[model samples]
Target: MSWSGLLQCTAVEKNGRTVISDCYYEGALKLTRPVYLHPSQPTIYLIHVGGGYVDGDRYKTEIMLQEGAHLIATTQSATKIYKTVKVPVQQYTSAYLDDQSVLEFFPDPVIAYEKAQFYQEMTVYMKESSTFIYGDIITPGWSESGELFRYDWIRSKLKIYYEDNLKLFDHLYLETSTGMTGIFQMEGYTHFGSLFVISPFMTQDLLQKFESMAARFPASVHLGWSIPMIPGLVIRVLAHETHAIETIFQMIHQFIREECFQEEPIFLRKY
Candidate 1:
């Protein structure tokens, strides 16, 4: 669809403070003002702003975080790319996190229709004491109505601070056809999601804990944990159901809530 609309929301908290702005919808929304939070507050602010498809094939969203701020931004719902008679749909998101800041970008899964093609890229920058959590969900195609598997291609990239300082750089690509099967790739599953966290305090013990949690899920779901050169842990899963994928995402969120937010004042506010 054509890029006919845009929405932008921004939040900032510092110390024990919290500040939120209204959702801005216009040709393009921008957060020129920096939201600040009290160091003691440890709050998370989420903003949902994006373009709803209409007729064009291209849409773009941008996010920026200042120094020492913590924010968790998510879209209100999965972006719908209506099937068209002409070309494939595309959505682009760009994010920036500054020094001593923490950001979690966990949007709901995107459901691709038959013949739909999607490409997404996320880039983050960290200076000192900065932490980030990122994740995405994708389906081979709409499973209802007995559509089964019909998507052409879906690919994504997660890039972080350019240095080997944390060993946190990875790329992912998935394609579906009438052929492939079993455990490693999709194992006959039609839904998949991945979670990545960047922190200065990741360790082998923490990695083990995450792996153990993932094991609680069904065997149909492929779960794995890795400690990349980056200072954080990475957890990935491929499942056959949307609810199962969401359950896994919520589990990881709870883990972060208990482990990272226990002593901090930052609270998770509802969307």
Candidate 2:
């Protein structure tokens, strides 16, 4: 029902603290005042005025962090993509990080209802001295009829660049045409989640530590950790529910906060 929306935000360090230097948004996209809850980072929550996205909607965002700045960007709530008959929803995000800067982009999960079609493309450009943490989840929307994985399609791609050179490219493509019920596809799972950390802090030692954590997941859940061509680690998870994956990501976030930033994890209270 909407044409498109755009949000642009720039962050800079001032007096040893990160602040939103400039921000602008249009259409359904909105942003709240940046909050410095933690001494090491400033937090910003993106808000959707419309509550959910619908067919024919296109949204894009760009975030820029100046040198030595630290920011955590997240959404107020889960993004819901409603059913569609014709047009598909499209979303694109681009982030630029200067040397010694840090960015933590952890939006809530996305729920795709029956017949919904969604596509997302994200690119992050950073210096080798910068740190980045990004994550997302995709789950079938609730249905009164108890149907799941009925969405028409859900495709997402993420690309990371260090020193303006491509370091990692991750992709996920799913469609109803491929039979979502197939064991090789969803494998009876209703949700999939991913967490990525790109930083010089992610050494082989830390990778081994995270691998120990991933190995503790229950048999019902499929969790894997891998080192891509980039200088970081990726955590991929599939499960019948969402809470397990969410908890693991939170633990990973906490680990990064304590080890790399030497700061305690501040609970992101939305209420």
TM-score of each: 0.77, 0.94
73-146 per-residue lDDT for model 1 (tens digits): 65556665445446555556655666666776767677767656666666665654777877788765554566
lDDT (Cα, tens digit) per residue for candidate 2, span 29-89: 9899988788757899998889888988899999999999999999999989998778889
* Global local distance difference test of model 2: 0.87
Q: Give all candidates' CA lDDT scores.
A: 0.61, 0.87
The number of the candidate with the highest lDDT is 2
Residue-level lDDT for 145 in candidate 2? 83
Give the clashing pairs for model 2. none
